[model samples]
Target: MARTRTLLTAGAFALVTALLPTITTVGAAAADRDGPGPVAVSESRGQLTVTVPPGHGGPGYRLLIDEKTLGVRTVRAGRTVLATNPAGGFAFGDQHATSVTTWSYAAGTLRIAAASTAPADTVAVAITPTADRYDLTWSVAGAPAGARTVSYQLSSAGHWYGGGETSEGAAQPYPLDAGQVSEPDFSPASYLMMEPYWYTSSSVGNYVRTASPMDVQINKSASGLGDFTIKSTDSYASTVFVESTPSAVYQDYVEVVGKPSKSDATPAEIAQPLWNSWAQFYTAIDQNKVLDWAGKLHAAGLGGHTIQLDDKWESNYGNLTFDPKTFPNPKAMSDQIHSMGYHFGLWTTLWINLDSANYAYAKDHGYLLAAAADSTKPCTVTWWNGTAGIIDLGKPAARDWYTGNLHQLMSTYGVDGFKFDTRFFDDSCAPAAGVQAGDYQRLGAEMADGFDLQGAGVRVHWGNQKYGFVIRAVDAGTSFPELRTTLRRSMAISTDGYPFVETDMIGGSLGEPAPTKQVLVRWAQAASLMPLMYSSTSPLGVVDHTTGKPVTYDPETVQLYKNAIARHGRLSDYLQAQARKSVADGTPIIRPVFFDFAADQRFYTTDDEWMLGPSVLAAPVLSDSPTRTIDLPAGAWFDTVTHRVITGPRTLSAYPAPLGVTPAFVRLGAPGAATAIAALSHQS
Candidate 1:
């Protein structure tokens, strides 16, 4: 007679069996001496199981669920199973993709079932660990059409298990170790992959789950590839889901706080110009020329809270010394700027030039990172003026020396804040000796922490992307609370894209034409909602690099930017309050569609439209057309421009987007402040 089912029972064992019509059992003679010769097949209820023959090789074992084979592990000593990474799975053909791992069972079977949404399509796997007898299910959906297959492999002596497509034959395997770290390539066109390994020892009591922390490498392939990576660690304990698709989210605010006040007791009066450098620029063009611009800005009610002396305000970029011959009295420039109701702001970078007086000072202290062991690789890199070398922030002595100089300038010269620039380029320095790639994050964090300690009250002007790495520099009142926790290095989207605090170069760098009227209008409307906003028109207001400078500004463009800035200033009180609330609640002032309409299918893939705050919905036209169409969310919305009311969940066409207008609306009954920012009319 054909062999029937044979039960192996032990005290306190949790047994779950799935029986199928094709059930078959092996007799005692076929059982191996070591164990049950690795049960080839077992099934009961909805569960299925298969064990690999010990020491078996090739491409690990495969589990045929619904006739679709999913890869499993084949180990020599004991059985090993593969599971998906919680974050996501890797892309099949693209190096930028992410991946996930599956869970294994001690003595029980696992079940694969069809997803509720997609019938007949097995979209989930359930693993039952006999040790805990806990059934945990991992659902898989949202797999792009590109990833059609998933396979796994095991090598003889390598601790790294390889994973790839059976048909593709190319595998990217990561080593399994306690402290092993790798930056895995991730891109919009690829998928994310993750694998989990668990060690179970009878001598060690219970099974311990182990996973490798992978840094998702984003934007590594192409410049415009709209993809970003997120770092993952084994400490993460949460259910992971693959969202439909990802888009960028922007949040953060900028505030200019150097405006002078009429009363000496006011907040503005207490703030003073921290540094003076106007003499360097004024020496070229007489003192009268320098004062003329200051008077014009004051007369036009446009004097910045802090008067920034741009490049050339210094004798040299690398030289931190003052040019006494030019200024005669450096203190007078600071007093003049302060008397005119503005704090003085200066620009500086980390470079130390050979020609500068500080170069010898820095060299004597051994502050710079030497390129060669001989200390003579010439710490040089090209910048604005000429060749220079950067002071290594990673070293404590260097940080102390740099901070001491800055502190002296702040305390002695009354300098309020430093406009730091150009420290992001990593290629400039030869990798420091004894520095490893994993130490990058900690080193950056340490530098930021040091800056925070030194410049306790002073504000640091930071670039948008740099903010992700050194957020600790933002002072208490300066930082938006909501952005603190979410600022990661490689987010899915651009952090600077939103109208936030770090002054965004208005038209963007690279000498692109000033944003089109539509871009400006949208930017203006969005900016109006930020804590701080400023217009960074190209130097001399000329943007086209090809044309040498008969700089002509459109009267309309000037009026629009002027109006936008003034309007932003006028609503500063309200915007500041909103920003404070956003920080307190950990919600962004600029929210994407999914935030407000998560369950709404219509807004799932929408990127162009976003909410400025809780009440206002801004749909800025990205195209050049004077009029554009906008889709509104559900409920009634009051037109911010026309005051015309309309119901949402519908698209409105031919919305006017003239040079100064942005197609914006406020939800009806929502509390918000909307003020027109048109130039004042002078009627005779």
Candidate 2:
């Protein structure tokens, strides 16, 4: 009988726990983690230490960053015990131990290679020290002749998160016990993206780099052991990177990975706000409304040069043509918009509608994944609309057609770029033709890269978070509850090392009823301090319940909105320069305060506020309260509004945050920045 590959149940994995793996708390008084064995520990200059146990599946590896224990984890529990019958000429005569045959530490490098019988050789693990992190590599002697799956897992203490869109930006507790995957997986409960990156309260970032697809399991053991598995179908080697960069998580990952930049954009374009039509008009939006709004926006002092024309303009998802009924003259419409000092962009996706004309054309042209064509059948993805045939990016010509259409929109109709939106598990739809998910991802990136404009905004999970494009937060609503979530989501994206990020807006995305006047002002106030301030909600769209008419912003509210944009415009050049540096070091322009103030324990708990670039720290009022309390790290800082120099290493009393202003302070830590507000004013 031929052996089949299946996910080993958590129950099956827990059985190995009986081996009594040795675990050390690293922190004082670790009880359950201690097992029978001597731990071989190694420390690096980067303040990271790793421990190896003497017994089989001993606590596995206990990791510590800055003397703070990240908990002990094991990687040996998932090693498959093969039961194939070699009698059918399927197995080699001799057998080798599937476990590590030898382990050694030399000159800051740890080599732990496994010896397996015949074709079942496990990867050789190598951990080398870098300036700031340990570069981990897992490789075989050469390319394997057959497909294989390998997994590396670990368990940590306290709270954990950082799995891109999968973790949903919320820190979740690992189950203290084990069980089967019982619930209908919703909101991407486990792994997200082809990239498997995660972080813990310990301030460590784990970057998984492999050509293979990844499966992440949290709380696989009832005892809360989280596991990350990489299944490589055709590769000979795979690598997963983990490092303790407690000082700066964003800078650490980008430095190890590649730094990304928008090559063609100017500094102004880099920091400019985006005006979106989604909330204002949805499918009802037309060229007239866009042009009319441009005038109104200018009158209201919110005119921006870039505009993103979101969904519903296209007749069909993948048709890639402007709806003739709604947009009769796209070229002229685009020209008029450009004349209004705006570069137009369209919202699009690779989703080919089954009933649309493009579907028939693509189906006939072999531009989709098919079954008889190897198990690589095309899958249907359902979203807010209905099901649609996914355009097979795994195929080159198919990708060409996809990009070609978008280019046509740019060259012919004056459409400058795209907001590439895709929220789904792409690996599930990968063709059986033996291509890795990265193939499709690279193709999508190719399409986005080929766009002439600098603002090719993409939601994560499609590919690695690269520089050339902007990263936007997933759609969020205007309610206080969802508002909090949206803010946290953006924080996660920043700390995850996405430099240029955009929150949906003050009043949220389309289909949302306008937020109350307070929410609108506060949201806008918060957004203005982010990397990019964008809005889909109009100034006067929020309805007044009693009058049944759009509520107009008071003069003060309008000035506040205009003041925020005007201020950002003046500082755009300086902001963009700081943003440009992230490509080399992976630093975040709009990041959590922990990046610079890691010593302050309060930063980890304060998720609602963020730092704009390296200069100002902003805390937006989340409630209807007139003032909100904030913890200021040890530093000399001045309120941006008042330029009042305040020394702080303590919590500030309820700070005043009126309806129109977001509380922000500029750091004056250096002698050159002694008058921080003055220094900032001069630069802007």
Candidate 3:
């Protein structure tokens, strides 16, 4: 039966190959060459075919497959089978370009070799197919003279359609620019040539413009999805150029289908109650001390949602065992927190300590990435847990083992969610030497997959840049639904359409001093519109290193934070409802100034002012100056603080902005409203 099944699969493959003209033989023998150089045409699984033109001069050869021109490459006569960029691109002189190459077969591989008369320059390129994507590897014989960079363009077809690039290497749906015009006929092919810088600027400044018509439109009526069609153009053939430089343009396009309904539960929603913390809860304050703080917050009307027992709960950093002395009875403590109306959250990174019991198992099983003998060597950097090694999440058994341990922690501690941190560190530290380059890419994808399969809502911190190939897997909306932090401009951009987008309350990192009264008000006013909000303060009360003093909040500053928290709590239901609408309909909580003032060209470049939903416009005083001039599009706006009505398309006169005030206004008749000012104050 087994033999028959194998034969049946082989026969099925053969049948498919016969029907598909693109399928070529794998590992076929090379033909003889009589000219100055060998011009070989090789096909792989029929989906991709490589043809090296005769007398291939210069340092490399060009790749043409499946009627699509992939990129140009440097070739060597012998010694190396393939030489190409780990990241894809074409380089001319010193310039690097962005582009994409599409593969046909759902699962297959391709390799191309070239022989050149130039002994100094040799190159080989290899392509391997996965279930959903392709892996490319390139090798060069000797280093090239002068600077080299890769330049290329991708065909926006299938899932490779319209999207924006992030400094983190993932492509996300571009935000809708109200006044900004998209080219007509802006299909995927037309916009695909518009190369947005992958890991630097998130704006359209890096895109390419052509004489041909470009047809593309951003779909925000539903969840943020980009649908585009590229009309065939006669001017330029669909080609990807490769050059050598700072890096290669390795492009990854993800086919993400938006949620059908806005009310659908996000990973954060499902995992909110499961949220746990490290030993920070106890270490920040003693058991009695935290109980007192928790009681105070409860009394202050500040409800505790989740009190995560951070790192200190463990016996040691690397040892996953509980610190019996500190935790005493963790179950009792967990029950106490629950009784106080808060869930539990825990933190764990992938690094394991040599002293831990799991260390022997990991070392013996070939899971640890460090030598047991030398702990001083920077196996991975020295983490919180002294002398730790990263666990190989790439291996199936290793992943299973890690998952089982996590499950054990949850079951034993009655924990809600796991704050999975540093899983990406695996990219830098592989368990074994000589691992294939493709294997490295696969490792990131596998780790993301493993986290999803583990059945726990994983919370990912920053570090999206390391695994450049994995889109949104970091912030990609796959592994984590809610992000930990949303920096200033990031909040404005990401919240444009993404639902469940949360930002830190009032102040971001607890280590920094709390915001001034005015800054606090502005931040709170902005945060109130977001789906998720929290107040995070450093428990250590240590002075900031840069400022060199413990952060002391003035009475006014404290009052403002308290007031904002109180207001947010009072309006939580309404705000959450709006957030639900946003999640459901792709409406942004924190809209850009341009969205509301689309017709006004002046607001296109303005980043300081933004709309907090449809009803309110928040113009924060970012500069240290006493007053700032604001550009308001034609509209009747009423000041929330003073109830003063001001007409649009005019500059508002100077107003006293001493440390406590922000120039914010509410739109006259926009729906879904909330304001710091009373309605009667805005009477006609």
Candidate 4:
């Protein structure tokens, strides 16, 4: 769904999400040890080595992936101090915790209890084996009476990654700052845990399953240290999963959180070409304008098979009904759009704003979140459009009320699907009695139960991957740098495990000022190859009302747009098949090069180039360079555009990319994926 946004006067950027990532799966085997009883060991798929210092307690372990040391167990580094604040909501583990209470080791698991005399708080640490990862749980069973929080840390010695939850985060690594605590939020600034999960090229990954109210964060300290910390609200049990590889590890994570299977969503449905009206009309929409655009999209031969009407159509935020003044006779407009052979989708947020038609009624009931005694004060959060009473989907009646409304949008209005979108990704929602931020998706997921969900989240929780929607990149601008950031984030997100992905329309989002013809054409070409052919920002330009003539671009860019759409339309099935595979395992359709060619360490850090599904290798010209180098692994790659056979495991000179033609190659192994692309595209 498109965003209902006011340009951030500051940066004009938008919120974002990290796809299919969390948890690692590892399995059991014989236990081994280099130290005595307390220092037991489990050599499952990987290995977990525990160390209980010669005493009653103080037990920790070092995680290893592919026989590489993952991270050392948690321990306080210096002299410990104690502070108790009654009004405090933030706290960290004491710097000096040198005492150990007890330790035990069994088949593929380590359990240890520790405490310090200064704070008199007892902490428990357990390491369990899984199918593709090691699960480390740190729980504090008893806390000093007045103390509101305690902390724990896991230090891994290597370059860190996975906290790419900011404006241009995916393009670079972050300093180990606690994500939530630092209060640096964009729509979905890494849902804290310091973007809670990460991995290293040394072949390791981490996901912190923050147990309820507790805030966990991880980052690489400036002083050559990678740290993972969990700061609990009170007593907490924070779980961390450490594993290996972008694909295998991410799949392992998804296996636990769960993603929708092929049945829940058809690749064909996802492959449908979409035309959104946000860019063309913004909020200045009307029934006539919508119909005109729908007609224009198809008539222009743009291949926009489906139509998505973004914000401003609704009377108020979260109000499902179309505004009477702007969209009079909604059904008629829907019918007209459908008559033109286009699928229709509406947009909505989950909250019920006070300004909305349903707000008073929702507030009358217990549908909105509220503080302990303040029944009149609706628990609302302020964001892009003032304050609104948020829905507590956990309340079945409220959920049914919201979803029931959605069903009507489908049956009555002929709306085929929706984009479940959100703008505020901040962590202040009122969860049902004991619900935590991570569980926020409980309502978000259910809201999408019976629809074609073409939705996205600016900020999402840990279990969001289970929702199984095509995740779009954060709204991007036309600036070349934004495009580069988008590419990097796409690779990171794909590797993080979100495979079914879509990008912003070619010229970028409404946030970007108008783009140049060159930028627009190239952007469209890149987007055309993506799983979903989308245009939130319409490719059409200003139109003459009286004459009905196209006004914006020089003819070349417009023609290029049509051609790109037609080319991609021919290969929709190929892209769909890859999506099916993604649901089966955790394979990212748009993946980092290393996911497939793992043996080649050179591709481990590759960013500009990527695999579209399993066959097409696309290296877009991000800069103004006429040509760039194509790095091929030790295999044969057939240049789709050039129709030339190229051997890999080598770097070769590439010619400049034509305006809309990217330098792409088809892996000989995936003949169909490669050949089909080869036949449809070319190099300049």
Candidate 4 has an lDDT of 0.55
lDDT string, candidate 4, 1-684, tens digits = 111112122222212111312223222332322223333343332223332222221122343321121223421122111111211112334422333344445555656555433465555556653333445655455553222232223223233345433443333322223222222231121432123455554344566555333232333232232333443343333333333344554555566656545423454445456677665666667888888778877787776657888877888887888889888898998898888887788877766677887898888887776643453566777755667877676677877887888898898999888876663223454456665545555456556656776433223445555545666666666666667656655555555555666665566664446666767677766766666665755567743223444447776777887777666666677776777776777567777677677678777656677788778887766665667777887777877667778888888776656675666777877736654564455432
Candidate 1 positional error at 397, Å? 2.5
Best-fitting candidate, measured by TM-score? 4
The candidate 4 region of ten consecutive residues with least summed lDDT is 79-88
* Superposition error at 24 for model 3 (Å): 34
Compute the lDDT of residue 240 as modeled in candidate 3: 24
lDDT of each: 0.37, 0.55, 0.40, 0.55
Where in model 1 is the C-alpha error above 4 Å? Answer: 1-294, 322-331, 370-387, 411-413, 424-503, 512-526, 538-546, 554-556, 601-607, 669-684
RMSD of each: 15.5, 10.4, 16.2, 12.4
Q: Write the per-residue lDDT of candidate 2 for residues 247-300, one digit (tens) a residue.
A: 444445565555565423456555567777776666667777777776677666
Worst 10 residues of 3 by lDDT: 197-206
How many collisions between residues are there in candidate 2?
Answer: 11
Number of the candidate with higher lDDT, 2 or 3: 2
- In model 3, the runs with Cα more than 4 Å from the true position are 1-289, 366-387, 430-486, 492-499, 504-526, 538-558, 570-574, 581-588, 596-599, 621-628, 656-663, 668-684
- Indicate whether candidate 1 or candidate 3 has the larger TM-score: 1
Q: In each prediction, how many residue pairs overlap at the backbone (N, C-alpha, C within less than 3 A)?
A: 52, 11, 73, 22
Worst 10 residues of 2 by lDDT: 81-90
